[model samples]
Target chain A: MVPIAYYLVLSAVLFSIGVAAFLIKRNIITVFMSIELMLNAVNLAFIAFSRQWSQTTGHLQVNGQIFVFFVMVVAAAEAAVGLAIIIAVFRARNTLNVDQIDLMKL
Target chain B: MHLALFIIFAGLCVAGALNLLLQRHPINSALSLIVVMSSLAVLYLLLGAEFLAAAQVIVYSGAIMVLFTFVIMLLNAGKEERTHGSRLAYIAGFPGAAALLGLLTYIFLSHSATFGQARLGEYLATTDDISRVLFRDLLLPFEVTSVLILIAILGAVALARKEH
Candidate 1:
């Protein structure tokens, strides 16, 4: 059995990488993916804690696992809509570069 | 046995995530993110969340990432032009991120012993187990998600339509 701390630490590192990607990436899709990565990392932590808590209580718990399901569902919906929007943006602006698409800027 | 698997998969997961960041092209980054998700699924298996591991593979890496890749191909999103936007961002951002990672690691390591090792075959939430609560106690959210997906499809069609 691997220690729970290691899982948490791994989750944290993954989350930080996601953060760095989100901050550094100029492409909007990559930025969006970094957000997904961060969500996955959070899901890992939730499942790990859920397992730890479930074991301590001497029963199988379903809360954390279930939340991960909802997160996936939401991510799917977001991706569909977001990609559609990205297509629209590309059509209108002719570029996917975040810095180039500043039409909303004053 | 489990520890070794965890170490290998976890290392892959982190490396894939870093690669996702380092890649200049969005498609390359998307591919690397798939690597991260697959390794994460394995880690999820190690943690005994078999159902989520499968979902992570199917929904996340399979569906969402495919959508990302398709968009990249459709739009022909070129490699990002390297912008020397600000040296301050590098001097500031890298250290800030490192500090945040260090803080999180310190906190996790300090509290490492609070929880015990998660053993396999001990998790109670099987698919049936999850479905039971999902269909019973959490039926509303499930229904809501379906509706959300429906709305998302409609929204996508509307948004991606020609301006004619």
Candidate 2:
């Protein structure tokens, strides 16, 4: 049996890694991927907590998994819209570098 | 057995994430993201969310990653060029992330007694069980997601259309 804390710790580490990648990576696509990584980490935590509740209550709890389902749905939607926006950005700016795409930067 | 599996996949997941950061090209990062997603699917299975494990594979690695790869290829994205990023970012970002991880780990470990252990296969959330909740209790949100997907589709099409 793995301690629930182990799963939570893994989630936290992955999330931190995602945050670092989001900050350090200059490519817009890579940054988008980091966002996905963070979402995945949160999903892991949600399932861990769901499992914890189920273990303590002596029954299967579907709520956490259900929320994960919704999260996945929203992620899919986000990816579609985000990639399209990325395409538009690429078409307009002709580059994927975040630093160079600072038209709005003061 | 479960602990060993968990450790292996978790390690793979972290390695894949690090590879995503280390890789210079968007395509390489995309491939590593696939690896991370696949490993995460395995972790979900270990956590006894069988349906989510499958969904994680099919939706994330399959559908979403393919979309990313297609866009990468379509754009002919080149390898990222290194720049002397802002000093404040380098100084604050790495340590900030480490601090966040340490804080989360400390909190989880401190409360481990309450969280307890997660024994594998003790309680499985079958697809049937999940669908019941999704359709009955969470039906409104479920349907709303469908609408959200539709709106996303329209937005993508509208945004990506040629200007000419």
**Model number with the top TM-score:** 2
Error of 1 at B27 (Å): 1.5
* TM-score of chain A for the candidates in order shown: 0.95, 0.98
Q: Each model's DockQ? A: 0.78, 0.85
Error of 1 at A13 (Å): 0.6
**Model 2 lDDT, full chain set:** 0.94
> How good is the docking of model 2, by CAPRI class?
high
Which segments of candidate 1 are over 4 A away from where they belong?
A: B85-96
Model 2's interface RMSD: 0.9
Root-mean-square deviation of Cα positions for candidate 2 versus the true structure, in angstroms? 1.0
In angstroms, how far off is B141's CA in candidate 1?
1.4
| Chain B global fold similarity (TM-score) for predicted model 2 against the true chain B | 0.96
Q: Encode model 1's per-residue lDDT on A1-106: one tens digit a residue.
A: 7889899899989998988887788888898899999999999999988888887888888888998899889989998999999899988988888878877768
Worst lDDT run of 10 residues, candidate 2 chain A, spans: A58-67
Which candidate leads the pack in DockQ? Answer: 2
Query: What is the Å distance of residue B152 in model 2 from its true position?
Result: 0.3
